[model samples]
Target: MLRRVLVELRRPQTPAGLAARLGVEREVLEAMLASLERRGYAGLAYPESPTCGVSCRACSLKNLCPAAASEAPQSPPVWRLTALGEQFVESAAEGG
Candidate 1:
């Protein structure tokens, strides 16, 4: 399941979108995301700046964006895999 989460996180995604994709509750998914973050497997997509560059509706990833994560999102952070996470995914793919 952790591997699956990392795989899905190849692209930026929100807690709610990820939860729905994984068939888990938002709270449960957040816990999992936290764990991955602690291990350097996942992290914020826009750590240096805010991600809301364009209006929500015009964004290509709107469906996976923080704004779409909830009815009301105050610049919710989007999650993505870190370098370590990419290594993990690569190793997993190679069955290492």
Candidate 2:
């Protein structure tokens, strides 16, 4: 389940979307996301348009993005891969 979540999150998607994709409850997926975040393997998507520079990656507001919910009907924040998360996916795909 963890690996599947990690790989699927390579692209940004709403939490609800992710849960549906994995056939899990939103709360279940959210707990996994939070765990991955604490381990530095995943992160929240930036609400605003991508900005240049490394600082943008570490912005305190990264987890508080409002634009994530701007989509029609509103939804939870999107999840995305971190450097570590990407590495994990690549290695898994390569059969590491």
Candidate 3:
């Protein structure tokens, strides 16, 4: 789950984006995201509505996320990697 979140964190993604990337249900993705948040592995950032391309707007299910709507739209979605998360990823990559 952490691995998946890290990949998603590399980009600004909605629940749908996670679902699609992870090949799981949106609810499952949401639960995993929540778990990551509880473990202090990730965060959410909502950016201003983009004026570029219709496809970009359709890329995420932002409308379904309450946290996304409550935050300032001007702020972009930022997934901060905690030190622990980074360490874990590095260790896993090194097969430690």
Query: By lDDT, who's the top model here?
Result: 1
Q: Which stretches of candidate 3 lie over 4 Å from their true place?
A: 46-80
Off by over 4 Å in 2: 47-75
Q: 11 in model 2: Cα distance from truth in Å?
A: 1.1
Clashing pairs in 3: 45-77, 47-73, 48-73
Q: Please give, for residues 1-96, the per-residue lDDT of candidate 3 as tens digits.
A: 658676555445666766777888877877777787788665555434322112324535445443344445443233434445556667777998
Model 1 lDDT tens row, 11-59: 7787888889999999889999999988878876642323334444565
Taking all chains together, the TM-score of candidate 3 against the true structure is 0.54
| Model 2 pairs in collision | none
Q: Scored by CA lDDT, what does every candidate get?
A: 0.72, 0.70, 0.55
**Full candidate order by lDDT, most accurate first:** 1, 2, 3
lDDT of 2 at 26: 90
Q: Any idea what lDDT model 3 has?
A: 0.55
Clashes of 1: 0
